[model samples]
Target: MKMSKVFRLLFIGMVALSVLLAGCSKSNQATSGDKKPNELVVGQDANPTTMDPHDTQDTLAYGIQKTMYEGLLGFDKDMQVIPVLAEAMPELAKDAKSLTFKLKKGIKFQDGTDFNADAVKANIDRLKDPANKLKRASLYAAIDHVEIVDPYTVKIVLNKPFAPIVQAFAHPAGLMISPKAIKEYGKDLNRHPVGTGPFQFVEWKDGQYVVVKKFDGYWDKANAAKVEKITFKPVPETASRIAMLKTGEAQFIYPLPPEQTESVKGDSNVVVDKAQSTIIRYVVFNVNQKPFDDKRVRQALNYAVDKDALNKVVYRGFASAPESAIAPKVWGFQKQQMYAYDVEKAKKLLAEAGLPNGFEITLWTPNDTIRAKIAEFVQQQWQIIGVKATIQQMEFVTLTNQLSLKPEESKLQAAVSGWSPSTGEADWGIRPLLSKNMFPTAGFNSGFYVNDQLDKYVVTGLESGDEKERLNAYAEAQKVIVEDAPWVFLTVPDNLVGKRKNLSGVYVLPDATQDVVHAEFK
Candidate 1:
């Protein structure tokens, strides 16, 4: 053969190999597609601190744990309390001190133990037990005793009329765990959570991922898990989380930062879901600390920071400044006159509090992108008033633990934080944050604020079953708390979730937790 003919033959052979490889690639693609999983992967802001339903105060943890646990009560999309394990709403006595619930029958825990009146009693007993020292124990303090009327019937006797009891029961703190698991694991139950939710705990790889699988014996088949498995992966970086969603690495990601919403919306493969949130973002002060101990200084900080600017810059106007101690979406929210933005007025208040020169303070925030931005904005705003704010960012878990320290031991001066009244009620909005008894060791009142009048009003709100009376009481409490300025009230942000367009049935609730019970891949 001539040299030209040999060159032509070599070219033909190369082209043939390319065609063969292309066909093999197509075959591999089809084979991989056929084995695609019916699983949901969620990218969240942070790792859950615990799996124990009764022990955690961490919002992220509770949200994930919700998939594996359920309470006798559950909340609808509107945050209204509804019966879940219970057959119907409880029957209240004339005095409102006693209530009875009829449990649903044929429900079994993930551990195969029966879910009955006995399970309810076991949970209540654990929460009320002084030795257990659960983080949410104070929420159930009004419960005097639990009486089993039958296998499926139970009566709760409260020491007094606790108006928010039913609503509180709808909270994750009320989520029931297997009594058998509770007894076996005891202190270590955080590692081995077992419940009767639509999903059962598969495993938790700390700082990595947590997984749950469909519970085959899940009682409510109509609302059963639509996916074989759900994996919660903590991707604290905002950009990384969005990239995961866009690339199909995750089915859902929350909360989609407000600034990034428009960008994510433009992606055809992703959908943004918004829910009006009960989350109240604020900068809480440590009243036990020097300058902050002065209400005028606290008020000055609130006056100094322009809430409208903060919302515009940090939340891109997707958030609104809180008009009450609680978000307006929560039940019994009463609007109040909040501190107006005035740098001069802020300086005046500081001078009146004997700090005319302005003092130096530390503001701690979680190492979150948004929160760090909040701290930075607050720092710049306070600078105009001669206030030198040194911003410190730490891991969320560390920041939370630092704040939980007893007032005398805690070194927290000011911290940027947020709370969602996950219970969707006024008492939860006020009691855990402002009531005197809630200080440090007892509840989330890390500020160590004390006001006898405010305390009385919260108690009144909690003890009264009358709607009018409770409303009036909460109104008064909000007035006192707003005036005292324990916190530089920030914004009530909308819960933003980014999901794959093909996904449905999962959403971020008004309380800002993910409800994944019905999540499915289309």
Candidate 2:
């Protein structure tokens, strides 16, 4: 009886050992096959409206496009232009009216088509084509035509000498798309974009997330993506986005509200990064509208704005008071205090404009938390000057459309808007906001403020080959615009970004776009 009992015990032990070995083998296979930890997830406030690079001007779309598209040139973290798909910087002709670029050979789009000079020409042609009506069509107005010198070389002939054209190529207007894909998909190309970027689009679940995976066959594989996959999820609510970052549900979040920066710093798993940005937040006057047409009234409004108070209250002292329409980061920004906050001065200007009793006006602002606060503050301050201001809120996209309408068809008296010149040049900062050429349908000029003297200086600045001469022209333009008070120059907010402590390689460009090409979790 003792021998039989010992045999039973030995059999049971052997069975238990086999079960343990099988469980270990299964776990190893599953880990190797599927649940890898090389994926990164990011949360942002908005979803991209379209994938077609040329069809949209939304910053969110540009952020997503950067992952999949490669322009002829790109900007470094310091806002300097660098060649991306081009073998080198373009060779400028002596007159600066033409540019020749040599394309990098052996590069192919995600759709497996060769990227050649023809592809570049096709993109420019599409952008300049009036039928397409791209929101950024005016950006390429200087380009007269494109000529292909060879399979790898192309020449761009300009109608005028445009000094900022090269930098403009680094903007979204310069992003290249697969011509083959465009032809096949037509207007539906936005749904299935193909590019020669480091990441290839996998799927986009509307209002939820966009998924992209590393393209192993990318041309520059050495500096290619470190993470295997990236999932960009749209968490519009600020609290929810912050919660995701804290819980590791999202590895990165951008435009981190300044009020929450301190709270985020207390979290052990998150880090906050701040950088000087070229973004300018200001209130645009509808120059075509009533009392605003009078320079005295506009100047009165500028003097009435308490920018210092706004920075401290709305931005939590994280923003700098703007001295000019162009942010200080732009090349030719000149420091000017044309209209300092002085309630007495504002009242005097209003009386000088024949309105001792301030009139009623409506101020439009987007339905954003910080902007809402700014609008309310402006209303309270204007009341001190005897002006009755009513605040209206709308979705950002709707607000943009409302600003785009013709003055006669629109009811925009004043609107709070922001501008970030994508090219990091003073010309872009000034021309789109003050030039008559940009009025009516041009996407950037919401104010329709026109001054012939400003236009002359802007044109001269664009055509000048000498750097010093260009700077002088832009400086003069800035001085005139500040005096004109087309906009109530407000603040230059720093680009605040939040990320998990374990994340690395995330970069914020000067224009406030996130560079995720090399982003990864440590």
Candidate 3:
């Protein structure tokens, strides 16, 4: 009996040992598999002031929002409008007063709410609400009301015939937020974003980084999020960003300084992408203030600056001199050389403007390396015409706030800035910058420059149904704006981008934002 008991105990011990070894083997295999690819890290030069789509006016902020929120429509690589949440391109009524959109079926928001026509209506109502005070309200000023035809169909009625309404829907102004999330978060929705995009907002570490993760339940699984995670690190210093890219810490960086392009290209593990951009850098004269109020003074400044030399020196030959406010790729862009580098003509114009001895002025510029260089170059050139130019640099947000203020309150004489129309339309590019109705804190016309003739042409371009008429109207408006010289047209910069060699599916849109939804590590 004692021998039988001992044998049974031995058998039990062996079985237990076998089970322990099997469990260890399985755990080892799982651990090896869990070592997946690292997340993609993108380095940006600026941090977004807010994440709310309706409140943000900065491009970087919009780029971050694009990862989490999607509009009814979106722009393709060629800048053409394409349907996103919508089933197809919206059908316009014969009278051109309404647009009907068929929403994609079976889509659900990240917050588990059903996405329907009512959600679209709710988004529009929130944006159009005066109590919300959205900066993008002006973009949807033409919307009379939204009608839900069914669970998956909606119609947007316009107060009048507006040409840019369709294009506006593709912009950040048309980004659809989850109504359920909005109701829950309310004023805090900027930080708590919920949408039906391929990625979901994970967390935002203030002044450090904003992180996002792939949404497994994304409707479009074919082009679903490839990367497991993405972290947008705010590295304002160009050198730091370059260092991060080289050390394999960051996979992408924007606005790569022209000087560093060659070095980045020399690296075997990195690549550079250069695309023609719609960004126009210019100096906005405070027409509400002295000397600048005179067209002759503005024209003289435009003539005095050697744009070609500025492009070569500041942009390192990576920029093209703009003929007008609109870029060359934009329709209705004039090929005419509106202003040539003529010191003598500039001097003559200054004398004609009754400032023969030249007047002292302060030129404000954002605290950006490129803009600062441009400002310094302009200051030197203006000195040749006896203009005592003082350069003052401030943060971009602060400068924009000062520019938005009334001339008496802001004391802004002139500021160096740039504008990129995200809509990819000439009407959008010209209207907000030159229209009188857009002045005094209405959609980026901070210079407060007003021209009745230009405004009329812009309005006609926005209201006309015929393409040729709209083209002619915009062309004429450009000519008038060049003559008025509200801004000294400088150069259209090339979007210089840097990325790791292993990073694929990254593209710079015409509007100069990175499309990283399909980005992956090879």
Candidate 1 deviant stretches above 4 angstroms: 1-36
After superposition, candidate 2 runs with Cα above 4 Å error:
1-36, 203-207
lDDT of 3 by residue, 1-522 (tens): 356888999999999999999999777643431233558889887666677887766777777888888899999888899999999999999999999999999888998899999999999999888788777787888999999999999999999999889999999768889999889999999899998889999999876999999988899888899888999987767778888887777888887878788889998878999989988999998898889889999999999999999999988899998878789887667665489999999999999999998999999997767788889999999899999889999867677678766545768788898888889888878877777777645567888888889888888888999989998998888888888899988889999998887788887787777788788877
Q: What tens digits encode model 1's per-residue C-alpha lDDT throughout 1-522?
A: 456988999999999999999999877744432234599889998878789877777778887888889999988877888998999999989898989999999999999999999999999999999798777999899999999999999999999888888887888899998999998998999999899999998999977899999999998989898899999998877888887887777888888988899999998768898877899999999988798888899999999999999999999988898899999898999999999899999999999999998999999998878899999999999999989999999878788889888877989899999888888888888888877888766788999889999988888888876789989999999999999999999889888899887888888888788888788766
Task: Score residue 490 of candidate 3 by CA lDDT.
Answer: 89
Per-model TM against the reference: 0.94, 0.90, 0.90
Q: Candidate 2: global Cα-lDDT? A: 0.85
Q: What is the lDDT of residue 469 in candidate 1?
A: 93
Name the top TM-score candidate.
Answer: 1
Output the lDDT of residue 508, model 1: 82
Tens-digit lDDT string for candidate 2 (1-522): 356888899999999999999999866753332233588888887666778888766666778888999999998878788999999999989898999999999999998999999999999999898887677788889999999999999999999989988998988768899999989998788889899999999999887898999988899978888889989987756788887887677778987888899999998768999988888888898888779999999889888989999999988988999988888888889887667799999999999999889999999997767777889989998999999999998766578778877657878889988888888899878887678878756656778888999999999999888899999999899889888889888889988899887788887787777888888666
lDDT of each: 0.88, 0.85, 0.85
Return whichever of 2 and 3 wins on TM-score.
Answer: 3
